[model samples]
Target: MPRTQDFDTAEVVGRARDLFWDKGFEATSIPDLERVTGLNRSSLYNAFTSKRGLFDAAVHDYLDRVVRPRLRILTDEPTRPDAAVRYYRSLAGALASLPDETPGRGCLLLNSAAGFAAHDDTQRSVVDAYQRELSGALTHALRAHDPDASTATLAHRTRLLTSLSVSALLLSRVNRDEAVAVANTAVEQLEEWRRT
Candidate 1:
């Protein structure tokens, strides 16, 4: 008979997600996962298939736990004129909350894209999907705010907000103030558009 999963897979994945979020995919060794998760190498492999498999699971966890919640600010309140601003501020707050010791611990998807995603098709696809989701949310917000906006205008704003959001996230890790500033500027620009 096959052995049942005696441990809580969610709990294991949560711990693994934190470690991967902190250390990136390539830098996190099996021993590191073992140490953090208290699972033996055999157990880890049996449970997740491989380190990359575990990392993929952790990336999905990050998306569900960290990324989706924030992205909701865009989708949930697409009609809100300040939805984009609120979204950016929330991101800034999350960035600010990170410990001072770990600067540049940016978005897991973005960081993974820069590192593991380049060489790993699975990682790259996950990152690409997240990016597409974000872009769609932005497009939704633009259309909500201005239902009659010209297609060209809507497309322009969507691209602009999507780019700004990615840039803000990357910058947040290195410099919180700069990231916040970028967000604030984008907010102001959006607000000005509303006023005019």
Candidate 2:
């Protein structure tokens, strides 16, 4: 007979997500996961199959709980300029709210992508999907501002805005203040784009 899980899967994955976010995938070992998730190696393997499987699940959980909501403002709000401003402002507010001692883990998906091998298709697919979601949101916002924008123009704007978004997150890991400044500049740039 199969053993039943005694612990809450969501709670376990949530803690694991935080651990993976705080420490990059390569740096986070099986022992670290065990400590953080409060599960023995046998239990973890029984639940997740392997360390790679747990990381994948954690990434999915992070995307569902953390990332998608943050990007929802862009998707739901119709006004392009305000939505754009809010997107960056919200990011700044979140970064500022983090305790100074906490390491700015930036985006967990991106952090994992940085260290993953090129041949790692499973992880690569997750990262690609994340980027696509972000790009789609940016494109929607840009199209709202200029309803008649050509496909090429919208694509360019999407790339530009997405770059800024990722850059702000990565920069926050190093310096929250600098990240805020970058976000402000991005907001200003978006406003300028709307003006002309």
Candidate 3:
């Protein structure tokens, strides 16, 4: 008979997610996973199949727990006309609030986009989906913010906002001030649109 699994899977994945966020997949090692997850190599392999498998699960957890929650303002039913503004300001707040070590970690998926996603098809697809989802949510909020905007104008604004948001997340790994500024720039743009 197969043995039942022990330990809290969610907690293990969350720990792994934080490790991966701090260090890219390539930099993360088996010992690192074992240390962070409190599961020996044998148990880790048996549970996740492989380190890559664990990383995949970690990515999923990141999206569900971290990414989606932050996006709630732009995604929840009856999205506010100011949802986009709120979202950008929140991004700025998060970046600005992070401790030195955490800001260097930046975003999990965004960091992966530049690292693993560059060569791995699955990783690329996942990152692309994130980009699409962010852009779509922003577009939805923009429409509510300006109900009479032309299709062309909507497309352009969405593109600009998406770039700014993505750039901020990417920059956080290297420069916290620049990252906060990038995010705040998005907030300024949204506020300007609202006022005009």
List where candidate 1 sits over 4 angstroms from the true fold. Answer: none
Whole-model lDDT values for every prediction: 0.83, 0.84, 0.90
TM-score of each: 0.92, 0.93, 0.96
Clashing pairs in 3: none
**Which tens-of-lDDT digit does each residue in 60-146 have in candidate 3?**
999999888988898777878989998989999988987876556777988988887899999999999999988898888899889
Clashes of each: 1, 0, 0
Task: Compose the digit string of candidate 2's lDDT tens values, residues 1-196.
Answer: 9987899999999999998888878899999999988999999999999988898889889999999888888889555547767888888788777778765879998887777735688888988899999999878777776788799988988888888888888877888888778778778877788787
The predicted structure with the larger TM-score, 1 or 3, is: 3
Which of the numbered candidates is closest to the native, going by highest lDDT? 3
Candidate 1, residue 129: Cα displacement in angstroms equals 1.0
| TM-score of candidate 1 on Cα atoms, chains taken together | 0.92
How much is 101 displaced in model 1, in angstroms?
3.6
